[model samples]
Target: MRASLVPGVALLGSYPAKSLPRDLVAGLVLTALLVPQGMAYAELAGLPAITGLYTSILCLLGYAFFGPSRILVLGPDSSLGPMIAATVLPLVAADGDPRRAVALGSALALMTGAMALLAGIGKLGFIADLISKPTMIGYMNGLALTILVGQLPKLFGFSVDASGLFAELIGFAAEVAGGATVPAALAIGLGGLVVILALQRVLPKIPAVLVVVVLSIGAAAVLGLGDRGVDLVGPLPQGFPPLTIPYITLSDVPLLLAGALGITVVSLADTISTATAFAARTGQRVDGNKEMIGIGAANVAAGLFQGFPVSTSGSRTAVAEQAGARTQVTGLVGAGAISLILLLAPGLLRNLPQPTLAAVVIAASLSLADIPGTVRLYRLRRTEFSLSIAAFVGVVWLGVLPGIAVAVALSIGNVFRRAWWPYQTVLGRVPGIPGYHDVRSYPHAERLPGCPIYRFDAPVFFANARTFREQILALAESQPRPAWIIVAAEPITDVDTTAADMLRDLDLDLELNKKGVDIVFAEMKDPVRRKIDQYELTATIDPAHFYPTLDAAITAFRTTAGAEWGPAPAEEAS
Candidate 1:
């Protein structure tokens, strides 16, 4: 093994070393979790249960080799399952020709993996942050609800049409009413759900899924659920997944590209969030780009190894961490365990009941609801809450892709609205406070002596550059036409060429004919100032107008423009 690959304290640069026995114990405990979840999530993805085993094996091995997290467990996540199936089923007949569909799905995985890897190398992982928290919450909640509603038929031994969520609901209602809800299948599913939920609440450390699996399989075996008409998993393939490549045609590539990009974005978002959460728990710093690379490698391996795309399984990772897992060694062990099960107990898996798996999926989906979180967000910010609801409704009514698109567009629109109508506040000094603040916020606050300083708390890009200039002009139109306007550049971290040009033009307006107020910048960083200098803005605007600090800018304005100002006027009685 490479020295860097070794599990040691020095590998993370800082953090304590964990004992080998602890990691082994954690691996064994989490393996129990990984096996059942792998199968359940594969079912969720509309793939054969055995594919879940294959997915578990390859993704674990991949993460062990390349993932930076000491305890992250990668496998088929419930969140991505419906996405994969929805993306693939429309393009081809899922049941009629599994081979072609599988190939296309694999191709999508490979493309997504390649995209994530490229993004990581390009240091563009920050793009994941563009997926606002509200959007994610809404998306997850909608997906979970869809999965729950869609799985009801399977759980109740009925069938559902694949038209859409509404169609499925109608079909389920028509087919699964009253006595049609098979006692055996419904009982098994509901029983499993109740058991998992109960165990999760009571004995979370006991690997509830594994316990439920063993009990349900045992009950099915004893009661002979097959003879009573309950569907079974049937026999699984014994051995490791054979090496395979997805066959992609030009036409298929175009069809799958949109879905592939969606998967890539979702996968990156999920992995980064998981990595950051675990890193926080362990007091380790996560490298977002590195996390992306690891996730990409895992998906690539999954695609090549007859497996579906994978992401960091949050439940399993938490289990591993809670069980004392220390390093990637735990993942390696878990991988070996999954492979062993695939090789040895392929026949035993045949007796696994479909409803039991559905229950497991339903239970997992329940956690994704975040009702309390949604309520809190609604209380805190009505606009954000509305956006989240819009996303949820879009996902439920339209589809996942359209929902994401709407959510992103809405977020971008909100940002533009905030930038265009930038809020301006007049500064005033408070009785007990030393510095001036917004007069609107602090009624007793006093303004700075001469210059009226205003801060536009956003990057001055093309979207808002012209608006920023207009706002500055409006401020200059005040009765006395303030002698100086110091723009607090702290929040304006970036300035594009358009903005620099506008500033230069504004400086000309102030200097040439005094058509506008003189503009000065405070707390401008070197990179921004460099751009300004490169644009020859200094030719029209004085270099002395830029100050390194707000205080310095105030001092200069007091010296240069203080004589033109008068004392504060009394407020008019309301």
Candidate 2:
């Protein structure tokens, strides 16, 4: 039925010939964005601008061959720049040898690719949810601030040797105060920034970035700005690098591996989100695992050719879509165009100003921020907002790598915390409403004369076994205590060994047994009930106390304990 079992094979087999011309035109438009952005993002990552082009070319071709989504574009992205720099730059020597840096960048890309490939093969695409939306928003906000700050010195035509965000900020201020600013550099950079912002706001459909870059280059050439001390891109290296596996010191593997895992996670998240957004418009389905495999292949291709790791660029993908791209042919065409430029016209952008590249990166950084998302989180939920703020502080106060670690740890901790002390409420019959409802939501709801129905929102596990026991004990000890306590257990999807043991101990506890307050379970899942029996908790918990529904439990309690419907005592009403 199929000519090839290879990934993305069907893309070509099912290709519509009518789309060829459109793909070609879209590819040319995409190339205009890719050349400048690829170079800028590479410089942002502390690599040579030429390596960015190599990365763009190889990744585009690789994804065309392996990526699942036809319209999703892969390339060097602004958000990944600081992360790549954090991982690869420290490994470089103090002199910052460009060759060593490229080698290390390539090695990092390979490690990232291998890890992502294995993850995809293992179907671990669910790890993308490891960072909650609030935390992710905070991380991006911090990254945006970090990038914007890091590029200021380049925009002003100087360099800050200081490390850390605070140190860089201080160093930048000192440089500006010490008259280290280059007038020509500032003029071009700010002028380009203003032009880009103006055009983007006034005519969003237009390619303002391409326009500003072209005008900047023309101005530099006409005014002889390079002679006036404004730095220029000069000339890019000609042609693509030969395909060869990257190498690094054996001692560096552990560090690089750690960074690679983080990089893979972030890249996977970015890819999935971008793919989903585009697939919605194109009426396609998303496959996260396949996306991972695709990105892994792209990174491998880039690594073999002296390039760093990359991620999805939403802006560039948007450009291709607007230019009427229909399939991977657009990506192939763009790759071929870049290859031809590298071979035939490497110096076409020689007059492009360095500050203009900074402007491009800074513009990308601005787009990376999700300030409105952060504010909305704060307004909607304060607890989640705290997690967001913590993530932000982690990125700003700590470094990028550590920030990622901190955000992950916080995400996991928040999950654990909610489970350890999940929401507990008393349920009762709300007049004419439904089966049951939280009494707190309706204070006048009817309740059993001597028993209370309680609901716990999480599974019973060791982490919250003690909290569950204590809350039950408190209810049993209250004055005018009920003869029976009913647990609405539908939400308790699991009961681990420790929690089962805790339940048995509560049954045997002197306080509950002495007071003649019996505990009963209602609407528990069958699997959890089996687990309780397996743990032998039914021995002390009483097998007869289990009921199929809350209604059954109430009927049994009323029959056995002779309880009647009435409002709870004043203090326990809600």
Candidate 3:
């Protein structure tokens, strides 16, 4: 089926009745995770904690209506939050106006959603693979480190004013040592961190944050942490979010565009990976483009309802599955549950501390660094290791955009670097083995008895086309004048126009009716054969010369050029 029609095809009816209890449990667990996670991610984005709540409620409801996954949870994510803040901060003035922030963020969400929708419709999901595993790991590790350091000040009950990540770290350190000296603040921050870390091991699902928050607010109310200069969550509106348009302008488009670009790329990658995992786990078929449309709708709706961009949350999805959620109704239930909290119990959340929220975010951010994978990369492939480190350094110093750009550049460079000098083999037979092997590695191997067979193991393009001809000619010259030559085309995927032209020229100059220097090709794929036919390379050499099987070519060579031919010289063989 075409991608545009997938949404309609993925009908939402016929859910199991057993899913009701599962949906309720999944809703409650997801709410627990979303509540603190929303607040922390909001802080990460340089937005108010209440914005997280707004984002969570709106995005969940939106996804429930449009998302394809029964259990996928969409909301503000820790990985993307810092990137959004970094993108928007440079455009806004000091202590940016809330109206301007809302407008810019909403615009970004819409832009991102539109881009994703178009891409899905076009079936361009494979574009996500352009970001290689190494580069992604490096970029994510750097992002994780940045988030951890950036949240330090908030954890210590102080704030830093620096814009760039490195400068922020320095400013935070300087302020922590000199400017801010609240013992109670330090205690709160440290206590929160310890509590969050320890509780993660024991009561993983109890929302350690809510416990720390209730205690912190209660202590502030009783022991007066507020009097000792501890930062507190100020008055938040006690009502459900009201729908409104953000103040959009022609000038704000470009700034928001950057955020949208980043968010769209990350969201597509995340959604695809998450959806595929769940589909595999549950033995269900997930339409990639369908998931894209679902997420796009959710983002569009979120922006309209004063929410930030969202992607499938891994933690919440896991909770839904564990709670036995079997249909999209679980997401609808979650949205309803969160709505009830917003309407009836908004005041119960007033006592949450910034430090506690920061701890939760820091914990999430820490998971972004795939240290084990990085170490494995270092041991396995140094080139990929270099790319990972480069991306990490670039993201840290140059910000997310420049870092992503560098990572892509590095990836392409690596491809060209390897392709320029692809793997070449000097064929020789192993002592006990019948076929020829690479002589350089296999010392005891013998060359082809008499004929020379040279294989160029990459697509013949402008970059390595000339190298292909030169290497084969040199191989022919290195050994005793060969009776015939066979160019194995198994590894050669394609030949460009330039390469084809080069082959035509080589045929005229090298073969030229010379009985002792005939050239034949075997195992060539149909596409290359078509190009060869189109270019008339097959005409001069006779139709019988192009053998589809390597054995047929070998048999013809033996009949026409005699079977007494032994392997050609090692260095000079073609």
lDDT values, one for every candidate: 0.78, 0.89, 0.75
lDDT of 1 at 142: 86
The prediction achieving the highest lDDT against the true structure is 2
Tens-digit lDDT track of model 1 for 363-473: 998988888878987999987898788878977998766666666676677777787666665555466767656656765555554467787878887778888877777
Clashes of 1: 4
| Comparison by TM-score, 1 against 3, better one | 3
Which is the better candidate, 1 or 3, if ranked by lDDT? 1
Count of clashing residue pairs in every prediction: 4, 0, 11
Runs off by more than 4 Å, candidate 1:
1-18, 411-423, 448-450, 510-516, 547-574
Steric clash pairs (candidate 2) = none
The segments of candidate 3 whose C-alpha lies over 4 angstroms from its true place after superposition are 1-11, 179-181, 202-211, 416-418, 431-436, 481-483, 510-518, 540-542, 563-574
**Which structure is stronger by lDDT: 2 or 3?**
2
Candidate 3, poorest ten consecutive residues by summed lDDT:
3-12
Candidate 3 achieves a global lDDT of 0.75
Candidates in descending lDDT order: 2, 1, 3
Residue-level lDDT tens digits of model 3 in 123-199? 87775555688988998898898898888888888888786788988898899779685677778777877887788
Q: Point out where model 2 deviates above 4 Å.
A: 1-5, 572-574
lDDT, residue 101, model 1:
63
